[model samples]
Target: MFQRGPGVPTVEVGALSADAYLLDVREHDEWEAGHAPAAVHLPLSELIARLDEVPADREVHVICKVGGRSAQAVQFLNAQGRDTVNVAGGMLAWAAAGLPMQAAPGTEPFVA
Candidate 1:
């Protein structure tokens, strides 16, 4: 689900700190279905308009269902001079790695 591109930075889920700043760039349904417990929601569709919601002081870990959309978000965030890294293998790998995830209160957690 992940790919190595020429320039955008990437990191595995294991490398992240327990409290790392995670940004979920998936669509609304994808996010609501399941997401990292600590992630901040900012769908790629609304990224540009919500740029200020992303942080500049701390490194941002961007993720999506797989890696495609996150790679795109990382590229854009990097170009705009933000410290961002694509979460390699995205949430699929995250789930496979047995990391914690959450869904809406009435739903069970799973990768969307």
Candidate 2:
């Protein structure tokens, strides 16, 4: 996928703890399909307007169906002076890595 944003860092799914606050930047439908139970949902389209929802003091680890969107987001957030990083490989990798997720009842978990 895209290399981490210009100066932004990345962390593998395995390296993160449940305590990490994952920022899922996918759309509403994608998020509804499945997402990390602990992740904060803020579609990229709304990120700028919802900046206050993200913790300024914490390092936000962003993700999407794949790495592209999240990498783009990392660049934007960094430019805004927010501490953020791309979760390399994104949700696809996160699922393959066997991370915890919450899907709609009766729905099979998959990156949307």
For each of the candidates, the C-alpha root-mean-square deviation to the true structure, in angstroms, is 3.1, 2.9
Candidate 1 on 2-111: residue-level lDDT in tens? Answer: 33467889999999999899999999899989999899999998989889999999999999999999998998888788999999999999999999899988999888
Itemize residue pairs with steric clashes in candidate 1.
none
lDDT of 2 by residue, 1-112 (tens): 2234466588888888778888999999999899999888999989888878877898889999888888888888887888988898899999998887888889876788
Candidate 1 overall lDDT versus native:
0.91
lDDT of 1 at 33: 90
Q: lDDT of all predictions, in order shown?
A: 0.91, 0.85
Candidate 1 TM-score, C-alpha based: 0.93
